[model samples]
Target: MVAGAPYPHELLPQLVEIFSEMSVCIGYNTSLDLGFLDRIGVPTEHLTVIDVMQRFVDYLNANGGTHRRASLSTCTKYFDYKWEGTAHNSLADAKATLYCYNMMKVIK
Candidate 1:
């Protein structure tokens, strides 16, 4: 393990394999999620990625102002997401992202 590495390189190939099998990967913030995956040795280039945060940035900036970063909680609440778990928890955030995505789909 390199200094401060979160996980060892073991399972990296499996992670890449999983991503290779994905048709689309949706993330609330691709810059963070995908970048973290890349930093952790996951090959992200092959996966078609969607950044929901960017998609909703216009709405987030609806007041004719520049886009400011919005937290997952804020986005979820805006979509009326009924959060089932604690905020800042990974699984909960993922669910919230999915809910927000579905809401966006409905709006479109």
Candidate 2:
């Protein structure tokens, strides 16, 4: 794990390699999740992707919710918070994902 805000690539590959062995990959609504990993040279072909956004979006649709936005900024506004640090940095992104998941639960 990284100790500070920005994560170095050297510290990340091992963790990704381990998790990539799994048959399934899951993330909220972010295609950027796997996309980012792929850009960094991780093989994503072995993994089956599932977007949790669909599940949550379906929930909202069923409940007649009119909010059509799910981007990070919109999500932050609706949920009443934003992530604490660097945007594109992987470690910060990970924390944002956790915070976003919690926020989604609250708003939904």
Candidate 3:
């Protein structure tokens, strides 16, 4: 997350408060994430959501000609991202997802 984006690893704390003030966000499965926020009564109409997981899927299907959903571990490992912590864990997954987004941008 940047200066204005919510840091979700805070256990998704203060969701309504945080998202209500944010204009953009980077997330893994943003539909589910945003859905949760919507269910919790957080209005997300104004958010520019960047779903790393979904973007990875679009990238793969566009370049590799495959239709499938890739996991964070798969995307991270494909880019040979060195983990700063345990995989599958929340914070680690967040970092890995962002890393995937970074690599995908530069590599083709």
lDDT sort, best first: 1, 3, 2
Tell me the tens digit of each residue's lDDT in model 3 across 1-108.
269765554534576677779998887878886887776577788999888888888988888658567778878877899998998677888888888888877976
Runs of candidate 3 with Cα error greater than 4 angstroms are: 1-13
Which of the two, 1 or 2, has more lDDT? Answer: 1
Q: Clash number for every model?
A: 0, 0, 0
TM-score of 2: 0.50
Which residue pairs in model 2 clash with each other? none
Ten contiguous residues with the weakest lDDT in model 3 = 5-14
lDDT of 1 at 29: 84
lDDT of 3 at 23: 97
TM-score: which is higher, 1 or 3?
1
Model 3 clash tally, residue pairs: 0
Model 1 clash count equals 0
Tens digit of lDDT per residue, candidate 1, span 3-104? 865564776888888887887889888888788789988878877777888778866667575876777877887888888798777788888888888887
**Higher TM-score: candidate 1 or 2?**
1
TM-score of each candidate structure, all chains considered together:
0.82, 0.50, 0.77
Stretches > 4 Å off in candidate 1: 1-8, 62-65
Better of 2 and 3 by lDDT: 3
Instruction: State which candidate has the highest TM-score.
Output: 1
